[model samples]
Target chain A: MTALEKKFVSFSVAVAVLFGVPQTVSAMHIMEGYLPPAYCVAWGAVCLPFLAVGIITMRRLVRQQRKTMLLLAMAGAFVFVISSLKIPSVTGSCSHMTGTGLGAILFGVPVTTILGVIVLLFQALLLAHGGLTTLGANTCSMAIAGPLLTWGLYQIGKKLRVPRLPLIFLASMLGDLFTYCVTSLQLALAYPSAQGGVGASMTEFLLVFAPTQLPLAVIEGLLTMLVIMGLETYAKTELHELREGRRGLFHDAE
Target chain B: MTRNKKIVVVSLLIVVLLIAGPLLALKGASFGGSDDAGSVKVEEITGGEAEPWATPVLEQLIGGELPGEVESLFFCLQTALGVGVLAFGFGYLVARKKYGGDRSGTAGDKEKNS
Candidate 1:
């Protein structure tokens, strides 16, 4: 494919992935029984390695910059705290993003996974965010999908020679939206509507989650972009020094 | 204090804050632990409650802006997942040490080579 074709194709895929899918898949907890039993089991199975890799990476990296890791963990804690304050969206339905871009950007995927998992776990135990049985599926949706896709986007953006700001923005946007998409897909598969039709529930799920998710993704993207830009411009030297010079627990380059 | 000492102390403080801060807030905010029926009555009408005093702690943990119920679920789940991850690490470490296998590389390496 030509360069232009590749870019278009990339952009189109990103758009479709972000927009075409139902918002439920793209945004919410996507309750457990929404997918087929087999699908949930399979997705949960697929998630095991991501969690494992995330843990090991955290272990190794946490040693390199204990201070940074602790700071980041504190940040993760903050994310959890702020996340608890909810806003009403639907009458009985509401949604929130993990705001994981910061964690993912600073500490990388594995650390983000650990952070996401911790956040979700507490949510389950304390606040009943998602159900106990659905924890695996929820984890795969937010912890894995958002950060992994964000990381992938980061790679692609880097490869395309995109600037850091736009790259981080795109990554954050894609990550945020892809998470909702996966969630919508899971919901569609699990709690299919009784329209006696093909993909009816999934269609509904998409419709509901789309409007909310689309704007939310853009907002998250902008926020992530701004935060990353600030960090890069203001603390470029300090962050670089910490990343390169310090032998701490959270080092990814090592 | 020396730079190393500062780092160590600050690091400890961060860790303590991350862990203890949450526990304390959760403790202090425990409606179960309080005779704050007036607060509960207010929360019932408002759909949620807020402790002005706990704002700083909550802000310290999650961020400045608060999320809605769904998002709150998302955050709570996020923290739970993080705990699971740390627990898994301890489990793996213990298992590795006990089993004494050469699983020294990482799950990522295994995925890559496979």
Candidate 2:
């Protein structure tokens, strides 16, 4: 195939991947039925308002930049590709990139969030990767929590006048790390330690995951930055309009 | 080459370096994920015999593990569907913007007035 074809293919595939982790340590999506019904319900409930907001945000974005629709689609496809590719982490577990933050950064928190929930749901049903019950928790960490972090960081980056690429790298990295941290905490809450209880359990999960998650976060961050740069070149007009639309949003708020 | 073209080329090179750099550096290494670590961590904290609070609903429904190939096929199909929906959706939006003109920009216009 031609280089153009390859680039298009990668555009669909390579938004995020890497720093890597061991699958045995913690898989990408919490497997089906991994969380108790109560945890599932609680997490699912937590996701509702975010998703509602996301739906609203998505509509607004479509109106703001017609080309944003394409960006949104590409973002979703990117998430699917990255999450599906199981990478070998240094620690001997098969892990995958969350790709949540990049979506959030590109499309805004709400729409990227909805995309995450839908993608997770699809993974649960189609690939048997994650279960239906744990959808809420998975969505919460990967979609809601991670993207929120990205949006906040992105805003801060804008205010601080940080170079766009570096800011994106940092935001993407933090977003990926935050997801693992939340997932670990979720697991910790479910099963507290013998002596120190929940805190200890949380600590234990963090320690175990840190070995892989730390590097993976860095890899993901760089990957996200590179992808955005690519978009800057290929999708310049859409990005410019989108940036203008976002600026108008904040400007209006003031 | 144009600036955009140069950046795209450099970006591709960077991507190639990322993938290859790691493979070479981490040769003979073990790569894995936390799928089972969460469970093991729970077990260690609670002591052995820590039963899973949940089990795979799909597994119970299917009565056993689905073949790996079947699972992979589903994943591929899901990716294709996701790509198709997103591409088509975006294409429609672009076309609409091209023909319909820019009514959406009206909202941003208000910002200028204030």
Candidate 3:
């Protein structure tokens, strides 16, 4: 296939899985049995080198500023703590922050890859939000799509020349939405049910998760944007240095 | 000079975070575990059980045994690799284009990178 055709096919598969398929499969945490051993092993193996690469990149970023490293670590820790402290949402479910949107926006995708690995490790080890066997899938869902989509939305916003706040906000919002949507799609694809299985139709799954997730995405996006914008406005010096890489932005904001 | 600029930015980020680090922490302490611990609560939902393409695999895994079939393993591996590579490669390119430095350079001029 041509490049455009390839892109189109990929896009169609994503949409088909996310919106067109059905069932209430728990895609995000990726329940243990849902993945084949080989898939898990292969992904886990591939993640090994990427994890090294991520560490190298982070070390380079950190060597520039020890405090920036500490701050990012703290930010990651804070995310772990807050997300673990889940709040009640719908009757049968609870929700927590994914924290990927802002992480992607500020640090870029490479660093977010590291951040994702760390966050997932902590969440699994300490909080038990996700299990160890399924860590690969979880990392792929949040770390991969979260940052990728965040960067994509940011570019779209840049091309449109929207204001900085709106740009960041929209980017974050869409990033969060796509992260959850992708996770849902991943689950559906992993576990396709018969016509009358417990898994709801893809549209039904979308309807169920979308209401809560869409609003949560907006909330998270705004929160992240506001924090970033607040630093930009009131603490421009800190932000300038942080953005410049001399000082970390979260260091001052926190 | 450009490298110095980068260093300066990184340094500033460190100091700023050091000063502002505590605020990122979630406050207050939980004195006790949540009420739901060890409680088996049945949730009533409005959906029927759906069929699965890999129901046997799912059942086996849930039952604490890995699937013995090689086809299942290949299926999962193929999907995982495809998605993993897509996620990593595309994600890297997007980030590089947006924030790695300058964006004026063309992103996808050659097939090798893609």
Candidate 4:
């Protein structure tokens, strides 16, 4: 309605369009029924507490800044679009950036985890993007583990006074790569190698996914940086307010 | 160049690579979902006697795997719902903030714009 609101809407559209274009977004997920029932339940359990924390954090953020709700919703949409955009690389290895690291950088690990899980669930149940049985493993790799690692590295980078843009790029890329590593490890564990056991199986799975994932990680890093720059230019005030405390979800609100 | 322009340029470049890089770099790429590939690999490695430890409830309910077109439809619907939820939430937040919802909030956003 207001001029500022219109401005926010337009800029948000720009950001969304960056991801909205229908590319060959490989639904690069561990397909449905890939994981055993026990694994699914265990992974689901692993995600529960994280989601609980994420909910509380989001609540605090909303209370702190009503605009946070808008930002988060937009953020969730962005993460969903970006992560889901697939490139058809790698013959058999479904390669796409896990799309979590950048979200983690913007909102921290916990919040990103919530978005990742929500998207993963919809992708699995509705679109068959991934299997329901392996939602836990997928969530763990793409949401929890990857984001935490990315945010941790980002925090370290901030402490070291690294340049902001480069640090973000590197951190997010590492996060993307980390997701694949965990995915490979999960698969390896599920089906240990008869020859070399977990280690060999891990190596094989890693090799299988590596070629596609590595390049995607680099592209993800660049794209994340670009998106951050756009947000900073268009949404500077929000960004400043957001990183004010900078400790974690708890700090941002306080 | 302006920051916004630079961002647009960089983003477009990334987009080009994301779509085209795969076509150029990867040959024999089925571009298939990893699940199918991973499952096949598992079967091969495990001596072709492998069985999935579980089946998705939805798959069972639907009587089998969904047709590809149906799967795409669901994905589109999910995306539409997600975008709708996000847009509504953003609008609501801005509206709430304008209505003096936050502690010190006001139409400060409007004043700046005016």
Candidate 5:
């Protein structure tokens, strides 16, 4: 390898070591076959409309501006990296960030939906972290619900004239938290509590996820802010176009 | 490092601490997966009637579960592929800035003319 390539490889290794060392066998997604066939089909059906819209939006954006393809790939990559890091938490349980916030902030909800489904699909097929049967339910919670919240928060924050960095942090962090909330709800719906019905079951699942996810949300937010900062510094022109609504992804961008 | 770089580094250190501090202080906490916890809770809630009814396709093909090492390998490969693409995007953008010399204006002009 050339000197630059060597340096890049070493840097990547250092990153892998830094994040990968603390990992345990903690496959935290609603694992394969965890949901019943009926619930699985229901969730999968729910995703079809949103995914259709997402694909349409993505296609329009790519046709309008080819540069968006690069940013889209980067956003997808961010999701992959962030989601794979199953960080340990104070609850003595481990969970991972959804990493959908950055994309939601940059490209809005529809594009994020597409990015999320692709990543979830890979995890299901390759790593067996999530299963194909459960992909629809998982996609609904992690991709659609999470990014929707993030995009909404970002748009609202912008309207309120919130500072950029903290806004990014809150939107990203809350998006991660909200993904788990939706997951808990899905679980609760699938397996309602006999004693108190779906509410009690949902609360139980939420409490189980909260302690681990709270810290993870904060970490995801910070990491997302750092990435945005890096992009603002280096990819100024591209971000400017994206933010300007030239790509027509964000409502406020116009 | 520049001031901005230092700030980024320190923030990263903070992130590291946030992750490690819990693992260190918890002292023998199983660090179990919440997904598993959720499953166990479901079983308890349903009086052990709610077992997962399907197996992963790969596991079905192999007639067994994937080994932990292989699972980690797949996860690493996923992360590596993502990081590689992300790096390429950033590198392309940076290189464009260096060589293309502020072409956003021209691109916009071209769009307007078209």
Candidate 6:
């Protein structure tokens, strides 16, 4: 075929492909019923301890300082907003932000864990984005593991005296990346490669997720930094109180 | 806009660019969900035997899968609820700073002491 004709044909083919199929709105959350029953139960069992801790921490914060309830709601809202946005990525696949990092940074791991699970539960039931059966697995990756890493990174960065913005950015971004990594590992564990085993299967899932997730992580990090800056600007007193309360609580633990 | 407002606007623009840049650059690519991609891989690995074992409750109740529009509506509602709560929180903070004045500090201190 001549060059112009070939170009025309390829353009038509692309248009056809785009319009031909009915698009299913699958999302980043492992879809409902995706995992086997045993795997689902196991993942749920693993999350129970974290959920318990999150509940206790949240209850204590609300009871001790009533003002924190509003902040906690805001944190949950942040997760909801960030995760709901499925931004397009370089891989030509869409993914979402965890938004757990901001909560973890602001409120710490246990409260963020609760926020993440709540968001996941809402997404699963209301939007059918994630499944009820797979809620445990999703909670493990998105809520518990992601926020834990973000909180740990934030703590370490604070101790190291890193600048606030960069530290928040790194913690949020890396936390997001780590969540996807955990997700890949979860999927690989359930369905190991016959030829190459779990390692190979994990590598495959990681490759599939990485391109979409990397850019998303950066966006999430930037957005989180901005939100933190905004909070510092407008809610200085509340933020200060939260910090003091966190320190006091830690001291009590020690 | 003030300096902080300017920064927020620029950062938001950058975020917009980050999302839009990929779509403009990668013409004709279907920006499918990564989860869908992961599921496809699972299906491939399992030789097409890795079907989802349960239906979403909504789908089950409806006796069919949700149409794309219905799904989008649900997503929009979710976003609306979140944005509403966020707006309320920020507005409350700003109002407290502006009008509540000493009352804000006194209330906060009371909570702290208690």
The CAPRI quality class of candidate 6 comes to: medium
Candidate 4, A243: how far from true, in Å?
2.2
Docking category for candidate 3?
Answer: incorrect
lDDT of each: 0.52, 0.69, 0.49, 0.69, 0.80, 0.80
Taking the candidates in order, what DockQ does each have?
Answer: 0.04, 0.27, 0.03, 0.29, 0.54, 0.58
lDDT of 6 by residue, B1-114 (tens): 787788788878988999999999999999998998999999989889998999888888888878899888877877887899989988888787778653568677779779
Q: How does model 6 score by TM-score? A: 0.87
Tens-place lDDT digits, model 4, residues B50-72:
77666666777898888888876
A1-254, model 4: which lDDT tens digit per residue? 33553464455445433432231111136766766565555566666656656666666677665555555776787666666666676453465567676578878877888889888887776666677778877887888888888899999999999999889889988888888888878777777789899789878777677776877788888877876775654454566667763466424343
Judge the docking of candidate 5 as incorrect, acceptable, medium or high: medium
Per-residue lDDT of B45 in model 5:
86
Candidate 1 local lDDT, A28-64, one digit each (tens): 4643223344444455554555555556555545655
Clashing pairs in 5: none
Reference-based lDDT, residue A196, model 5: 98
TM-score versus the correct structure, for each prediction: 0.55, 0.76, 0.55, 0.79, 0.86, 0.87
Query: What proportion of the real contacts between chains A and B does each prediction keep?
Result: 0.03, 0.44, 0.00, 0.45, 0.77, 0.73
In model 6, residue pairs whose N, Cα or C atoms come closer than 3 Å (at least 3 residues apart or on different chains), thus clashing, are none
lDDT of 5 at A48: 63
Chain B TM, cand. 6: 0.81
Give the Cα error of residue A233 in candidate 1, in Å: 4.5
Tens digit per residue, CA lDDT, model 3, A165-185:
678777877776776666555
Q: Which 10 successive residues of model 4 chain A have the least lDDT summed?
A: A19-28
Summarize candidate 5's per-residue lDDT along A1-254 as a digit string, tens digits: 33553464455445444543332101136878888776776677666656655665676567666656778889999999999888899888888889999899888876787899899988888777788999978887898888888888888898999999889989999998998988888888778899999889889889888878999999999999888888887777667667655433323222
Which predicted model would earn the best DockQ?
Answer: 6
